[model samples]
Target: MRTPADFCADKDALLVPAVRIVVRIVGVEQQKQGDAHVLGATEPELKCGPGVDNDGYFDADTPLGPYYLAPDAAIRLLTYDEKAQRMGLTDPVPVATLRDVLKACKSGKQPGTPYTCSGGFFHAAMDTKGVITELTEIFQS
Candidate 1:
């Protein structure tokens, strides 16, 4: 298996489902502002996963390949698309409740992580457990 300490640098690390679950859970209680906020493990940005604002870190092992620490100001679902553009969905709606978001990430089907690439499109089913597992591997060891 791959550990977080095994990671290197200058590479695109993919976020896993399990990792997302853990971070999302811990992030909720963490700070929710500034760079250090998301990576603090108490910010809600944990749900941001690995791409946006990339704000999460881990000191683990990963002989599989290299990886870069996300950051500390990652964004979340509701924070991503403020104008829902998927599935005929128009207006901004905070559909993800704290309880459900946690349950889904743990269930292995997160379904969304918040992305406003288009400023109006909302893509669901964006799980991050994969990356979560990678960054959080050391804690287990």
Candidate 2:
């Protein structure tokens, strides 16, 4: 199993193009009703490269890969009810409520803990300097 330590070991090594990285969530601080003010997580890992479909939603033959991480500040949080109807959950759940859900995910006290309502996968567009210029959420789960 890959751990945060693995990702932190060589942050530069994981930046190769077509390589997908998976980051683990450490904490979340919701700013607005739906916007994640600050989403903290561990570094990323070289989870997989091109041609592998980690999530079934993508076409197996597609070249694009998603980098999984704690949703950045750009992400909008959705409520339990809103998330259930995945067509588009625009309404933001309260930060306190989201904290409860995140706590449950971490504590494993509730069924279906470690929930996706708090995180998402992004299709990151990096610049020549390897800086992420744009991160579009391809999937929220």
Candidate 3:
């Protein structure tokens, strides 16, 4: 079984195991693989906001990895309904939210707010191949 530490540059380096991480979507790049195209994660060009001290969070300006979304990954947009005391309402409107978020980020315009950059941020679990297996939208509290 591969772990998050495998994503590190050094193979023998000791690192903590991480199953999930919050990441800022800067943009996406499509590359042709065989007969199909695959989208890879992209990072921002400049540092333009205050830094957070979260361990597994990757800001847009961090320029972290060549992470890719798995072909069969589960992607969902979640919103908390205050009255319902629940999050991740099964709404169809936010179904394509992730794509829109990436599109806005790729446009090169600053997001209206720091946390809501291009709508919202995401927390995902990546496999050893640097492929995101699960991606879920998260809102700032």
Candidate 4:
């Protein structure tokens, strides 16, 4: 498996502070080209610190960026049980593949769904169109 650091190794990669938050999904809208899903939230409330179980923290004051998922973005779903091993709680297992996650996010619009999104290190790259070309989630395990 490629470590999170590997994703951001590119010279042009930008490191952004990821914050853990519980969001009551207000709405989920799909892009016309079927390339992304825009998640609408009622102001995400901080669930824990920036890291897993509040073990580590990032810039708490950093504002939450755009709430959306790129179709090709790397999605890692770390379960509570899977994180019990040496990999740590932040180490996520790929339950729903990236494609499935994107599909779910697009079609599954469960308003008021309480979702816990942990903050991790996100290595992102922006394209000339101001769109995210790559996004990798790196949780501190």
Best by TM-score: 3
**Model 1 ranges off by over 4 Å:** 1-92, 95-98, 112-141
- Tens digits of per-residue lDDT, candidate 2, 1-141, equal 122233344547733553443333335564455433344543333333444344222222322222222333223333333445433323333445445655675765541322344343333444454333333323333
Better of 1 and 4 by TM-score: 4
lDDT, candidate 4, at 17? 32
RMSD of each: 14.9, 11.4, 8.9, 9.2
| TM-score to native of every candidate shown | 0.20, 0.34, 0.48, 0.37
Distance from true location, Cα of 10 in model 2, Å: 22
User: What is the total number of backbone clashes in candidate 4?
Assistant: 0
Cα displacement (Å) at residue 63, model 2: 29
Clashes of 1: 32
lDDT, model 4: 0.38
lDDT of 3: 0.46
**Candidate 4 wrongly placed segments (more than 4 Å):** 1-29, 39-56, 62-64, 67-69, 76-84, 88-117
* TM-score of model number 3: 0.48
* Model 1 weakest lDDT span, ten residues long: 116-125
Instruction: Give one digit per residue, the lDDT tens place, for model 4 in 1-141.
Output: 223333234323333333222222333366778657664433322232334453333333434444665565444332233344432222332323433443454465421212222333343444544444444433433
Where's the lowest-lDDT run of ten residues in candidate 4?
A: 110-119
Query: lDDT: which is higher, 3 or 4?
Result: 3
- What is the model-wide C-alpha lDDT for candidate 1? 0.27
